[model samples]
Target: MVVQQYRDGGGARAVRALAVAGVIAVTAGCFGGEGESGASDGSGRSVAADRPLDLLGRAADVLVEAGGAETRTSMETAAGGTRVTIRGQGAYDFRRQMGRLKVVLPEDAAGADGHRPITELLAPGALYMKNRGAGVPDDKWVRIDTTALKDGNLLTGGVTDPMAAAELLRGAADVTYAGKSELAGVTVHHYRGVADLGRAARAASPQSRGALSAAAKGFSKDAVPFDAYLDEDGRLRKVRHRFTFSSEGPEVSVVSTLLLYGFGLPVTVTLPDEDAIYTGEIRQG
Candidate 1:
């Protein structure tokens, strides 16, 4: 779930809209199954038996070289024994740090017709949303300063930024080669570890540093557990990160998953004009 806090007049107001709902509850699950154990590292040695911190750390660099790719994202959160998953699909330009996604919220969040797919533009430090319900006009866009979000828009956007997700791996530590696995008909190397968001911020590119740095401090903990899959070419084919937020009542758990494919795809993202942004008060749930 997503929680958006923006300043109106001289005070800040929190909007718990259905499209960008605030965190309620979540439960983290372990990563296991799928793929064999003790796979060979191409030299008669078991790759899974070795810790490949360097390989995991370079995952972002590899994506940058790939130019761009089509992306699919899934975020699952549970509240009061009910779980909802938000799904998105789009393309991302890794080099430019820009992308476009159409995110769909579950029907239960809104009435059947009200849960229209929201168009989101992901840029350096801001997020633009269209069809963002919460007393928002259909023709106007809601612009959010990602830096101001407590989670740095990581969890607030419902879908994690693909580029940011890859960059987070730069701080991978205590990583272990899980084994070889087949994802979407392609073989990939699976690795599991915990990433230091603070370290990743320092190593991230200029476009992502500030947002990641803010995320490092906003989350319940800086160390985020993840499962990353990279192909032989070193490109990040898939990644899953578990985040916990404890700023309010109980700790909230969120599982963010990103999948990348169709490399070298052309992607175009344009930001909205100042006049197109909504500056009025956003109604709360």
Candidate 2:
């Protein structure tokens, strides 16, 4: 698939901002307050002390076992001194490594509303985006190879792939139990740690390894700080990751958050036909 180029202009700037800003965000007021500490039971404490890494490493597996779930994602970052937020709602089939998301970008500089939401299809190694708004045809979908992206589609996709986010836990290190918390009325164990991208790539499943490997080399640092909340069943309910992107200018900070619920939900995602994909060059903005 050919990468869509952007033509220079206000529209192009908005598109570029979406691409760069999609890669990172800060989580502020995205979740409920952290409940009081020391709320875990004896068993929970034992598990936390004995094998936090082991438990965290299996987050993806737990999701897979649960079949599918609904997802909500938030990406927030600052651009040109103004804060931008991108929100997404979707559903994922963990067993098939397929999902669909409706991603809404922030208003443009002029504060104009009514920008169409982008539809994103998530597959094992590819990302399909429609309504991308870089001069591409309305019916054409832009296909991107996740493994080819520097950030491994994590940051580039606006919202991090939920499964990829879980697989990242495979590299959890220096993990510490941060007490207990309530997320949407469910009690969960809160854990904080830094994940090594290289290690995560090696430990991730075949479907996620390549993209994670790309991200390991793409980011300024391989160690990603995170906070994770898991339910009693060891399933991840919510996770927040902090990432930094650096270029010729100052480093850009990003915080990406994913929340999962309604396990066992039916999720169906169909990839577009080859003819439906946009193969033409997208002019740079």
TM-score of each predicted structure versus truth: 0.83, 0.84
TM-score, structure 1 vs. true: 0.83
Give the best candidate by lDDT.
Answer: 2
lDDT digits (tens) for residues 13-69 of candidate 2: 333455432532222222111112233456646355456787888888888998899
1-285, model 1: which lDDT tens digit per residue? 124322121111121231344321111121111223345769986664464677776777778888889999998764334456788999999888899999888776654556788888999998888877655667877777677566677777789999889889988888887878799998888889999999999998888888898888766589889999887677889999987544333344578999999999988888888777766432222
Instruction: Give the per-residue Cα lDDT of candidate 2 at 243.
Output: 77
Task: Give the lowest summed-lDDT range of ten residues in model 2.
Answer: 26-35
Error of 1 at 255 (Å): 0.4
